[model samples]
Target: MTTTTTLKEQVLMTLKRQQANALVLYLNYKKYHWLTYGPLFRELHLLFEEQGAAVFASIDELAERSLILDGQPVADPADYLGTATVTPSSGQLTVKAMIEEAIANHELIITEMHQDADVATEAGDIGTADLYTRLVQTHQKHRWFLKELLAKGDGLVS
Candidate 1:
């Protein structure tokens, strides 16, 4: 007999994916933090560290949410790459490239969280929905910061 996946299972899967993405994003941010150099070295270094910490903080919350729902979080580090939607950065990249990559990942996470939050809400899991709602704000803020760094236009003084 074939068994259909329950709403809880779907929610759990989403949570796992989120957790994996958080870990991957955090690592990528840290990579950028360490590798970033140029005229904006100090500013970019601190900014990347701050954002990486924020993403790292959510990893635990996502994992706990899975446990609370009677599901398992992706426990093995080896599994993160397979589960995460966000792709990891590799090799040395230009500072601009790092910032652009981060912006793209943040955008990806923001979109996924909105969709995941809806799925959780549909499953009657308001707590999970609320978590996603709150976490999305962090990604949005990070994305905004990264985007602003790339903005170039005439200013009042220029």
Candidate 2:
């Protein structure tokens, strides 16, 4: 394949993976929003809902970017679960565990976004590179928030 073709495929793959990750993350946030309890219930519930909205928006952006590159974005909910790099949480988890899970999921996406951005840059796809850069920044910010929450107090409640 030509370089342009290869780059397009790479970009599309990255976009799809990102879409999947965002979908899973959004769903996980919603889960936590509904299930979180105890001392931090109100705070964590609101935060999870807000984060869910943010991730849902990112999912739309990823799909649009894929279409802009003339690639079909995965649209089905099942597809998101199947393609996601971050696995969805199952069973019951404590509030602290939910926070830790979110942090880990963000880390997974951040690592993938960094790798995708590097590939896009090497392939001369500046737009895709920029997209990944922005995504990385967003995930990093989210990760920082989760980490800071974990850091507060004596680990019992933050």
- Give the TM-scores of the predictions, in the order they appear: 0.94, 0.92
Question: In candidate 2, which residue ranges exceed 4 Å CA deviation?
Answer: 1-5, 153-158
How does candidate 2 score on lDDT? 0.87
Q: What tens digits encode model 2's per-residue C-alpha lDDT throughout 8-119?
A: 7987888899999999899899999999888777888898888889899999899998998899999877788888889998889988889999999999999999988887
What lDDT would each prediction earn against the true structure? Answer: 0.91, 0.87
TM-score of candidate 1 on Cα atoms, chains taken together = 0.94
> Which candidate wins on lDDT?
1
User: Largest TM-score belongs to which candidate?
Assistant: 1
